[model samples]
Target: MAIEINRITQVNKAALRLPNQPFKRFGTLLVTRTETGWHHQEQLSDQTFEQTFPEENYQLSAIDAAGFALGAFEGSRCVALATFEYDFHFNRYLYLADLKVDPPFRRQGIAANLLNAAEPLAKAHHKRGLCTIAQGSNLGANRFYLAAGFHIGGLNTNDYRFTSQEGDTDIYYYRDF
Candidate 1:
């Protein structure tokens, strides 16, 4: 069946609580800066490891108030989701706080489709662009963001400092409209 992309309505907002699908990566993307410009290179780790972000409980009201939320469905089942919110922290950009596709539905362009659906909604809100952050160790996500026309705009080297995730970097990506 074809995956349907639809705006998340209040009645079906619960779809945002998708099942956690952990990921494993064999290496991490290392960021460096030279006189020329920022650089990103992948370094293979000694061992493969799985990482899973803590589960998030998104309030229905908050989801409603967000700039937009979309779900990719195969019939009645929601297999993927994307949510964006207006961020004026630095500029008028929509922050893609959440984007996920279940394991069985991945690699079929569902995630990309959701991103395509989000761009117009963001443009409709008069936002300048869309932005998001991915863990440096998540090679697949970093690659996807780059392939989707986003550039590595910045990095937070201290975002995970003093935590279990210390040594992990937060890579920020932005796609200008």
Candidate 2:
């Protein structure tokens, strides 16, 4: 497929039936959270996560609110996307709420390309930075965000548990432009 990353223009019926984006799940993110600090470990395995962006059922509303959305396309099909907005509460940072690419297209820089597309949009909106959250179970995503220059912003242990092999903590990451 000839991949093209472009701005989403129309959200018609055709756009609603996007292809499913799934990723192979490998390992689990082991986290130990205490009153004083946190510890993490990754135990590799062979598993998979299939996502059709079920949340995207509400994507039109998100598209309604977003500063913009970028679609990574294989021809006319949207195989990947990054959705975000400039909420005043983020101060100078744009809040990146969703970023996903189909498993078939992983490790090809599709998400990063979408993010690269987002930064200029954020800057054009007069924003200074960007921020996002990664679930503790998604160690690959955490590594991606870190390598992309994002750092831990904060954590909410109460939202998730520490004992389970799949952690429930929200790991916030921020990157300044």
Candidate 3:
């Protein structure tokens, strides 16, 4: 089915989920830190790791926060979702909070379209740039952000301490307009 991208409505917000298909491809992200510095790498794998979307009001809060919640719709069903909020911390940078595409729609360019669509929305809000945070263990996500020309803005190795998810790290990236 052809994909259509647009901002999601409040009613559709509850449908926010990790794709409908099984996540069958990923690479293990290797993270290490020492006094010398930090090292991160990805070990390619054919493993299919299923993904689960944790429930949160954050996506809906995007609209409430002077931002938008973009969705990639395949007809009436949403195939992907991307939401961002404006920030004054960096002269109105668009801080992306979520970007998820259903597994069945993988490799279909829906993600790219959604991201491209977000740029104009950010610009419309007079935002200076785009920024986002991702888990260090998510190698694919890290690669996508890096390949999109975003530079590492910050890193907090203990960012996930409260969640107590072991060595999970928070990686922040940003692109200047």
Candidate with best lDDT: 1
Model 3, TM vs. native: 0.76
List the candidate 3 regions with Cα displacement exceeding 4 Å.
Answer: 10-40, 43-51, 57-62
Looking at candidate 1, what is the lDDT of residue 48? Answer: 87
Per-residue accuracy of model 2 over 42-126 as CA lDDT, tens digit each: 7775666643335456455567476666788887787887778788374888888778777778889888888887888889888
| Candidate-wise lDDT, in order | 0.85, 0.72, 0.73
Better of 2 and 3 by lDDT: 3
Best by TM-score: 1
TM-score of each model, paired residue for residue: 0.93, 0.76, 0.76
lDDT computed for candidate 1: 0.85
Q: Rank the candidates by lDDT, best first.
A: 1, 3, 2
Q: Decide which is better by TM-score, 1 or 2.
A: 1
Residue 66 lDDT in model 2?
Answer: 62
Error at 10, model 2, angstroms: 1.7
Residue 171 deviation, candidate 2, in Å?
A: 0.3
Candidate 3: the clashing residue pairs are 19-102, 24-48
Q: What's the true lDDT of residue 152 in model 3?
A: 71
